[model samples]
Target: MLQLDLKTTVFLASIMSALMSVVLLSAYHSFPRSIRGIGQWVAGSLVLVVAPMLFWLRDIAPAWISIVLANGLLLAAVALWTLGTQAFYGRPPARRPAAIVVVAATLAVTWFVYGRESYEARVTIVTFAMGIFFGAQALLVLRHGGRDFSARFFGFLLAVQTLVVLARGMASLFAGLGGQTLFAANDVIQTVYLGSYTLMDLGLSVAFMLVITRRLHVELDILSRTDPLTQLLNRRALYDAGQRELAHMAEHGGEMALLLIDLDHFKHINDSLGHAEGDRVLTAFSAMLKRELPAGAHPGRFGGEEFLVLLPRTTMAAALALAERLRATSSRFFGRQVADLTISIGVASVDKAEHRLDGAVRRADLALYRAKSAGRNRVEAVMEAAA
Candidate 1:
């Protein structure tokens, strides 16, 4: 049992250290400019410092002093945990006065206990205060906004820690009153209480690490589907969306439209000015499209100098009108000195029986080809060609 307890303590300490390192490193990389990240780093670093302090002070002179210090360290950990939770949930800044109150109260109690003649009363009061503060914070998180698994896990950990503190407080109170006279009995109680609390703290730390890892994974997935420059769905995302839309339309009877827009004389702009200026134009045009399109429309960069817009509930006439509006907007905006910049738009709306988005896009391409051949800066509907 002694070997097992020692191994568990060491393993828990190592895990806590690893989690603290990850939180610090991630904050550095992702949130260097954020004040909240800085606060979390400070808190995490302090916890790392204090965990070892708690272990070292276990056998220090005047047992109440060690108890006071350990409680103080746990309070610090709670404060840091609050800050980290707020940062993750995008909650507003925590009140400074409340944080100051918690810290000052812990310190004042620590000082008072260190000077107290009766160690039992001092330890009991300090332990109760620790439990109240930590338990209250955990309950607040659980009641307000901790809906995710990480938040719930954290709450559970805090509740368990609070119980451990309460158990320790009871043990100390009983020992001080001479209710448990045997030294071996006291040792067994102390060992069990410390062992349980250590394991609880270690579990919470690991849970927080898992939450950060999961959040990072989700962010990476979003980045993969988004265009870095335009901040729009990239071609791959658009293709997936198109496939889904195709399947939905096959089941329901609704018209879907595809608009393929190509900038006129884009190569000339790159040649006359610079690629940098050309990039600006593309970005500006993308922003304009995003602003002009109605809600529920999906716009994406099809490639260099080309864009695609999907309108799920639009008819052929409505799609043509939107294309015309886009052409006019581009003409007015890019007319000053950009070679009378205009867009040739090919619009194709699904016919009543058509069930394929790819077929619709091919028809739109053909119409767009005809529009360019006839004259640039025009909206050509595929149905118009057959009419």
Candidate 2:
């Protein structure tokens, strides 16, 4: 049987960790600026790898430079990982707890070395510190990530690592102390500890890259389908969703309603208030649609200053009411937020299979033109055609 020793596992893991860090850091920098926190994750992995490598040098170097330094670096690495997780979920990085952990661990390590030669005490305190940091990193992911699968998985991984570390720390109380050094390549307990640490930290390094990549993919997907300024589904997404809903309603049997909404004098607002403020108007109107639109309504940006809302299982009168609500919400925000910002909406109702959604949208567009002609900030309903 081939037995794995502490130095062998630690050295191999260190080299692999450094390589992984380089690749991850390179990829993170090459990615678009929208995806945040990859840098911190890579840096943390690098520090973690270096910490173990430093431990391997304990026999040749001073205890302060080797054991204490390695433990301090390990704490720093956990802090970086926690900070990265915060950034991953769009939360501000917290520094106080990390500072506290580093300070406490440093003091403990200093006292163990200066006041006494109790290696067990020194190792026990370091284990608890590492466990605390690991637990904290896990909590950061859970708190900010909520039920997100990737985030939860990463947090769970940290929790597992924490359990292993904390168990070792407590187990030390009952285990017999001997003359074996932590870095002794042949020490059984040392080998077990180093092997477990290497495996767990390696898993963390790999997991971080996976989570970052998944986040970047998700962000790219959202960016592709949504309007950048309004954060609403774009015209392509609107058409796709409309087609899907039409198919769904065809099978399920429901009335499908389409509303074409045009911001009243949107061009005038852009020219008068500048495009920057005009963007604010569009964003505000999109927010109102999100809040006030009927339940299950899919609101999308149809074009410049124009939006499309699809409501399923709706009657003509109900569709009209929704359109009026939309008009009112936009009109109510006029003068106070944006200069005279209001919307003209055209409502069209039809059975799911009566005609394609594009045809219904065209009819709704015509009604919207009618609303603009009659007066701005009003809803005009296009009646279902005779069978």
Candidate 3:
């Protein structure tokens, strides 16, 4: 018969709690800024308080101290639940007063029960209070923001914690109800319970760390491929897309058009209104281009005030018509406030018979120079010379 002592049980629980706290702290430091920092702090606090309390349980003369500590842990968990709800679901503070009230009531009940004559009453009250709190937190998270991965992940962790608490409560209840025989294999039962809880805790922590890492990676990827000022595809993305389009055209005999657009005297905007206003103008112009272009077309900010558009599966004539529409749209949109806020557009189409994408852009650049000479606010299509 393998008999276990209470001191050993408390020691093991303390060690496991401490280990979990360290793991969570490591995850918190490594987590992305996007994750709610408050949630991490709450988790860290819960582990810190509970672990030390578990170790001190034997030395404390009055059992009421342990009861108070347990209630305090639950209180911290409830506060964490509130912060998690706000961060994950964007919940208003006024929406869930019930949560706070329940936690307060649980704390009061736990304190009152600890002073009761019956040890069974104390055990039952504390166990049920913690279990209920965990379950409620899980339900709230699932109801409010279950769609997001982080919300669901937190909810799952809460649910598992609730189950662990419930199992502990049941073990205590059986012991109190004069069913000592039921705990004949108490050591085995407790070992299994602790093992399962530890595993769940570790799994949830690892998942959260992975989620934060992935979010950081995605943000970095977007920053690498996007222009910060205009919020458009940067030159690198544009060139890569152009190369891919050209390769597809070569393989499938489809046509694509490229339009290089330059803002006329954009330097005048910066000089007159400051760089902030210049940024606004560029952002507004980019938005207009995005709104005007067709679904298949790709637009990019090609450094400075220059922009490029790739029109896929379109003929030279269609490209010219699209450019004319864009020119007209810009004129109408910017006519009132920004005087002479005009653009010069040079259009070129893939000429599979004679030139490649780069050659076509060069020809378009020549036409663009011609357009500036002919006066801005116009579109020019490059006409290939005779072979």
For all predicted structures, in order, the TM-scores are: 0.73, 0.91, 0.73
Encode model 1's per-residue lDDT on 1-387: one tens digit a residue: 333354355346546655666666665467424323345644654565565455445555454445556556656666666666566656764748447745775666666556644545655665676676567657766775347787677678778778877877897777553443211233665566556655655566666665565566667777788888888888888888877777778787687888999998898889989998898888888898999999989999888888889888888888888899999989988886476788999998766555546677788888888889988999887774233
Q: Which window of ten consecutive residues has the lowest lDDT sum in model 2?
A: 171-180
What lDDT would each prediction earn against the true structure?
A: 0.70, 0.79, 0.67
Q: What digit string (tens of lDDT, one per residue) describes model 3 on residues 1-387?
A: 656554444455555556656765765676665656435434744554474354246336454455555445544554554455455444554335535654665566555545444444444565566676567667776786436676578678878878876876786677554433212345555555445544544554554454455556767888898998877899888777878887788788888888999888899999998999889899999999999999978789987999988888988899899988988888887786588788889988767653345677787787778788999999998866220
Candidate with better lDDT, 2 vs 3: 2
Mind giving the per-residue lDDT tens digits that candidate 2 earns over 222-270?
8889999889899888888878888887788878888999988889987
Q: For residue 96, what is the lDDT in candidate 1?
A: 80
Clashing pairs in 1: none
Off by over 4 Å in 1: 1-49, 59-69, 92-99, 114-196, 333-339, 351-356, 384-387
* Evaluation by TM-score, superior candidate among 1 and 2: 2
When summed lDDT is taken over every stretch of 10 residues in candidate 1, the lowest stretch is: 177-186
Give the lDDT of residue 230 in candidate 1. 83
Tell me model 2's lDDT, rounded to 2 decimals: 0.79
> Regarding lDDT, does 1 or 2 come out ahead?
2
Task: Please give the lDDT score at residue 108 for candidate 3.
Answer: 64
- Using lDDT as the measure, the top candidate is 2
